[model samples]
Target: MVQVHIARSGVQLGKYPEADIPVLIGAGTVRRTDHYWKKGMAYWLVIGRTYDPPAAAPPLPAASAKPVPKPMRPLRYECLRCGHKANTVREEKPGNFLMEICTWLANPFVGGLYTITREAGKKALCVNCGSEHMTEEVW
Candidate 1:
């Protein structure tokens, strides 16, 4: 049971069994450029030069065998007032710098909670006319 030391990018990953090295490479855990050192070797050597994957070894299984989900059509938006059509909307929120500073000076704990809740509340506006009145169209 020979053990091999694996290193990559100047950092030692850990020692792994010699037989498992090829399995690691197949699983993407080990790369060809990674360095390895074992007993009887004077210095470290690139794994690509020393190891060759066995031709009889079974190929790695697919990461995901499930069928992929079909792509969804992008949401289309039309501004009711301006009659502008667009696929994107902009988020509108007022800056709370002054309020945040005042709250932080009073109590840092409360200020952090207030800032998080305030930032999470956002209003989406139509990109064309910057109006909140918008209707969604699938097609």
Candidate 2:
């Protein structure tokens, strides 16, 4: 059976697999969440238990496909002075990168009941120039 079963108190996680006869009933503690349960040879009455990882299928061909292609370069720009590279950031159709990220960051809270707060991803920055704009990741 699955180790992580929801319980009444905090949660009643199982220590042994469903295949074995359960004697001890303990809370679903993080340490007991193993894939398999082992029996103890040393302790007869108080024997042992363990967890085993679930079986997974072998990797399929498509699961190993190449990464999506990117452009030779993007709108990412950088500077030569600070070397703090970053991606161009903006919100709405803001005037600059700062405006973009700011908009994205606040959009969630500002959207109110109907709107959602999406993650405003950070663009790559030019470490050499301290610019908060990234071109693409060079091969």
- Tell me the number of clashing residue pairs for each predicted model: 0, 35
Query: Highest lDDT, which number?
Result: 1
- Please provide, for model 1 over 3-121, each residue's C-alpha lDDT reduced to its tens digit, 9 standing for 90 to 100: 99999998999999999988888888989999999999999999994666677958888788778888776668878888877777786655577888898889999888778867776
TM-score of decoy 1: 0.39
lDDT of each: 0.83, 0.40
Model 1 ranges off by over 4 Å: 57-139
Clashes of 1: 0
Q: What is candidate 2's lDDT per residue for 55-110, written digit by digit as tens? A: 46777767667888886554344444454334543323214555545665878454
The count of residue-pair clashes in candidate 2 stands at: 35
In terms of lDDT, the poorest run of 10 residues in model 1 is 88-97
Give the residue spans of candidate 2 off by over 4 A.
1-118
How far is each candidate from the true structure, as Cα RMSD in Å? 22.1, 24.4
Residue 113 accuracy (lDDT) in model 1 = 78
